[model samples]
Target: MTSSDPHAPHCHNVPGDKSAVQPDKKRLVSRLNRIEGQVRGIARMVDEDRYCVDILTQLGAIRAALDGVAMQLLENHANGCVAKAIGAGNGEDAIAELMDVVRKLKS
Candidate 1:
Protein backbone atom coordinates (compact mmCIF):
# COMPACT_ATOMS: atom_id res chain seq x y z
CA MET A 1 0.00 0.00 0.00
CA THR A 2 1.20 3.45 -0.85
CA SER A 3 0.93 6.43 1.40
CA SER A 4 -1.04 9.44 0.22
CA ASP A 5 0.93 11.90 2.28
CA PRO A 6 3.12 14.15 0.17
CA HIS A 7 5.68 13.70 2.89
CA ALA A 8 5.62 9.96 2.41
CA PRO A 9 8.57 8.42 0.57
CA HIS A 10 8.43 8.67 -3.22
CA CYS A 11 10.55 9.68 -6.17
CA HIS A 12 10.15 13.13 -7.64
CA ASN A 13 11.97 12.15 -10.81
CA VAL A 14 10.57 10.62 -13.95
CA PRO A 15 9.77 6.94 -13.69
CA GLY A 16 12.26 4.41 -15.15
CA ASP A 17 15.16 6.78 -14.64
CA LYS A 18 18.44 5.57 -13.08
CA SER A 19 18.17 7.98 -10.21
CA ALA A 20 17.52 6.70 -6.70
CA VAL A 21 14.00 6.64 -5.24
CA GLN A 22 13.39 9.26 -2.59
CA PRO A 23 10.15 8.81 -0.78
CA ASP A 24 9.57 11.82 1.50
CA LYS A 25 13.02 13.33 1.88
CA LYS A 26 12.01 15.31 4.91
CA ARG A 27 10.41 12.31 6.61
CA LEU A 28 13.50 10.23 6.00
CA VAL A 29 15.72 12.95 7.35
CA SER A 30 13.53 13.28 10.41
CA ARG A 31 13.60 9.57 11.04
CA LEU A 32 17.35 9.44 10.70
CA ASN A 33 17.65 12.35 13.06
CA ARG A 34 15.65 10.53 15.70
CA ILE A 35 17.64 7.37 15.15
CA GLU A 36 20.87 9.31 15.59
CA GLY A 37 19.62 10.73 18.85
CA GLN A 38 18.65 7.27 20.02
CA VAL A 39 22.11 6.00 19.23
CA ARG A 40 23.66 8.81 21.21
CA GLY A 41 21.35 8.10 24.12
CA ILE A 42 22.33 4.49 24.02
CA ALA A 43 25.97 5.45 24.07
CA ARG A 44 25.38 7.66 27.08
CA MET A 45 23.53 4.88 28.80
CA VAL A 46 26.40 2.54 28.24
CA ASP A 47 28.90 5.07 29.52
CA GLU A 48 26.81 5.60 32.66
CA ASP A 49 26.76 1.87 33.37
CA ARG A 50 23.03 1.55 32.94
CA TYR A 51 21.32 -1.77 33.56
CA CYS A 52 22.03 -4.49 31.02
CA VAL A 53 18.32 -5.11 30.38
CA ASP A 54 17.64 -1.42 29.82
CA ILE A 55 20.42 -1.14 27.31
CA LEU A 56 19.28 -4.28 25.55
CA THR A 57 15.75 -2.88 25.35
CA GLN A 58 17.02 0.32 23.75
CA LEU A 59 19.08 -1.72 21.30
CA GLY A 60 15.97 -3.61 20.31
CA ALA A 61 14.12 -0.36 19.76
CA ILE A 62 16.91 0.87 17.53
CA ARG A 63 16.80 -2.28 15.47
CA ALA A 64 13.04 -2.00 15.09
CA ALA A 65 13.32 1.65 14.06
CA LEU A 66 15.86 0.76 11.40
CA ASP A 67 13.60 -1.99 10.14
CA GLY A 68 10.80 0.54 9.81
CA VAL A 69 13.04 2.75 7.69
CA ALA A 70 13.93 -0.18 5.49
CA MET A 71 10.30 -1.05 5.01
CA GLN A 72 9.47 2.49 3.93
CA LEU A 73 12.29 2.48 1.39
CA LEU A 74 11.22 -0.89 0.06
CA GLU A 75 7.69 0.32 -0.33
CA ASN A 76 8.91 3.38 -2.19
CA HIS A 77 11.01 1.22 -4.49
CA ALA A 78 8.12 -1.07 -5.28
CA ASN A 79 5.77 1.79 -5.95
CA GLY A 80 8.23 3.87 -7.96
CA CYS A 81 11.02 1.87 -9.59
CA VAL A 82 9.31 -1.49 -9.90
CA ALA A 83 6.05 -0.04 -11.08
CA LYS A 84 7.83 2.16 -13.58
CA ALA A 85 9.83 -0.76 -14.92
CA ILE A 86 6.71 -2.81 -15.39
CA GLY A 87 5.05 0.05 -17.21
CA ALA A 88 8.12 0.36 -19.39
CA GLY A 89 7.66 -3.23 -20.66
CA ASN A 90 10.32 -4.69 -18.40
CA GLY A 91 7.91 -6.33 -16.00
CA GLU A 92 9.64 -9.67 -15.98
CA ASP A 93 13.05 -8.24 -15.19
CA ALA A 94 11.65 -5.89 -12.63
CA ILE A 95 9.74 -8.64 -10.90
CA ALA A 96 12.83 -10.79 -10.79
CA GLU A 97 14.87 -7.98 -9.32
CA LEU A 98 12.19 -7.23 -6.78
CA MET A 99 12.07 -10.87 -5.78
CA ASP A 100 15.80 -10.86 -5.24
CA VAL A 101 15.49 -7.78 -3.09
CA VAL A 102 12.74 -9.40 -1.02
CA ARG A 103 14.89 -12.46 -0.52
CA LYS A 104 17.76 -10.36 0.67
CA LEU A 105 15.51 -8.39 2.99
CA LYS A 106 14.11 -11.59 4.42
CA SER A 107 17.53 -13.01 5.01
Candidate 2:
Protein backbone atom coordinates (compact mmCIF):
# COMPACT_ATOMS: atom_id res chain seq x y z
CA MET A 1 0.00 0.00 0.00
CA THR A 2 2.96 2.21 0.38
CA SER A 3 3.77 4.33 -2.67
CA SER A 4 6.97 6.02 -3.73
CA ASP A 5 4.98 8.89 -5.16
CA PRO A 6 6.05 11.83 -3.05
CA HIS A 7 2.67 13.49 -3.16
CA ALA A 8 0.76 10.38 -2.14
CA PRO A 9 -0.87 10.00 1.28
CA HIS A 10 1.46 7.74 3.22
CA CYS A 11 -0.05 6.28 6.36
CA HIS A 12 1.49 3.86 8.86
CA ASN A 13 0.19 2.15 11.99
CA VAL A 14 3.56 2.55 13.68
CA PRO A 15 3.71 5.14 16.39
CA GLY A 16 4.81 8.51 15.00
CA ASP A 17 5.08 7.05 11.53
CA LYS A 18 3.36 7.67 8.20
CA SER A 19 2.08 4.69 6.15
CA ALA A 20 0.25 3.79 2.92
CA VAL A 21 0.38 6.08 -0.04
CA GLN A 22 -3.05 6.85 -1.42
CA PRO A 23 -3.25 7.88 -5.07
CA ASP A 24 -4.32 11.27 -6.42
CA LYS A 25 -2.69 12.93 -3.49
CA LYS A 26 -2.28 16.21 -5.27
CA ARG A 27 -5.98 16.47 -5.91
CA LEU A 28 -6.77 15.44 -2.37
CA VAL A 29 -4.40 18.06 -1.02
CA SER A 30 -5.90 20.68 -3.28
CA ARG A 31 -9.33 19.87 -1.96
CA LEU A 32 -8.04 20.09 1.58
CA ASN A 33 -6.41 23.43 0.81
CA ARG A 34 -9.74 24.73 -0.37
CA ILE A 35 -11.37 23.45 2.76
CA GLU A 36 -8.78 25.22 4.85
CA GLY A 37 -9.54 28.44 3.01
CA GLN A 38 -13.23 27.99 3.60
CA VAL A 39 -12.57 27.53 7.29
CA ARG A 40 -10.56 30.72 7.37
CA GLY A 41 -13.36 32.54 5.61
CA ILE A 42 -15.84 31.21 8.12
CA ALA A 43 -13.65 32.43 10.93
CA ARG A 44 -13.50 35.86 9.34
CA MET A 45 -17.28 35.86 9.02
CA VAL A 46 -17.58 35.14 12.70
CA ASP A 47 -15.19 37.97 13.52
CA GLU A 48 -17.25 40.32 11.37
CA ASP A 49 -20.44 39.21 13.06
CA ARG A 50 -21.94 38.00 9.81
CA TYR A 51 -25.49 36.71 9.72
CA CYS A 52 -25.99 33.36 11.45
CA VAL A 53 -27.76 31.80 8.48
CA ASP A 54 -24.98 32.68 6.07
CA ILE A 55 -22.37 31.30 8.41
CA LEU A 56 -24.39 28.16 8.97
CA THR A 57 -24.69 27.69 5.23
CA GLN A 58 -20.91 27.87 4.84
CA LEU A 59 -20.51 25.47 7.71
CA GLY A 60 -22.76 23.00 5.96
CA ALA A 61 -20.67 23.28 2.81
CA ILE A 62 -17.52 22.65 4.80
CA ARG A 63 -19.00 19.54 6.34
CA ALA A 64 -19.98 18.18 2.95
CA ALA A 65 -16.55 18.90 1.51
CA LEU A 66 -14.85 17.16 4.42
CA ASP A 67 -17.13 14.20 4.00
CA GLY A 68 -16.14 13.94 0.35
CA VAL A 69 -12.47 13.85 1.29
CA ALA A 70 -13.10 11.24 3.95
CA MET A 71 -14.91 9.00 1.51
CA GLN A 72 -12.11 9.29 -1.03
CA LEU A 73 -9.51 8.30 1.53
CA LEU A 74 -11.68 5.48 2.78
CA GLU A 75 -12.03 4.04 -0.68
CA ASN A 76 -8.31 4.26 -1.26
CA HIS A 77 -7.59 2.55 2.04
CA ALA A 78 -9.91 -0.31 1.17
CA ASN A 79 -8.65 -0.76 -2.36
CA GLY A 80 -4.99 -0.48 -1.42
CA CYS A 81 -4.29 -1.32 2.21
CA VAL A 82 -7.23 -3.58 2.98
CA ALA A 83 -6.88 -5.37 -0.31
CA LYS A 84 -3.23 -6.04 0.45
CA ALA A 85 -4.09 -7.28 3.89
CA ILE A 86 -6.67 -9.67 2.46
CA GLY A 87 -4.13 -11.04 -0.01
CA ALA A 88 -1.77 -11.71 2.88
CA GLY A 89 -4.44 -13.65 4.81
CA ASN A 90 -4.74 -10.92 7.40
CA GLY A 91 -8.10 -9.78 6.13
CA GLU A 92 -9.94 -10.20 9.38
CA ASP A 93 -7.87 -7.68 11.23
CA ALA A 94 -7.87 -5.30 8.31
CA ILE A 95 -11.62 -5.56 7.94
CA ALA A 96 -12.20 -5.05 11.62
CA GLU A 97 -10.02 -1.96 11.53
CA LEU A 98 -11.86 -0.70 8.50
CA MET A 99 -15.26 -1.20 10.13
CA ASP A 100 -14.09 0.56 13.24
CA VAL A 101 -13.17 3.63 11.25
CA VAL A 102 -16.38 3.42 9.28
CA ARG A 103 -18.34 3.44 12.52
CA LYS A 104 -16.37 6.41 13.76
CA LEU A 105 -17.04 8.29 10.54
CA LYS A 106 -20.75 7.59 10.86
CA SER A 107 -20.77 9.25 14.22
Among all candidates shown, the one with the greatest lDDT: 2
Candidate 2 TM-score over all chains jointly: 0.85
Candidate 1, number of clashes: 4
Q: lDDT tens string, model 2, 6-84? A: 3334444443663876678878899999999999999999999999999999999999999999999988887777766
Alpha-carbon error at 14 in model 1, in Å? 11
TM-score (all chains, Cα) for each model: 0.78, 0.85
Off by over 4 Å in 1: 1-17
* lDDT tens digits by residue: candidate 1, 38-63: 99999999999999999999999999
After superposition on all C-alphas, the RMSD of every candidate to the true structure, in Å, is: 3.8, 3.7
Candidate 2: C-alpha lDDT: 0.82
Model 1: what TM-score?
0.78
User: Lowest-lDDT window of 10 residues in candidate 1?
Assistant: 5-14
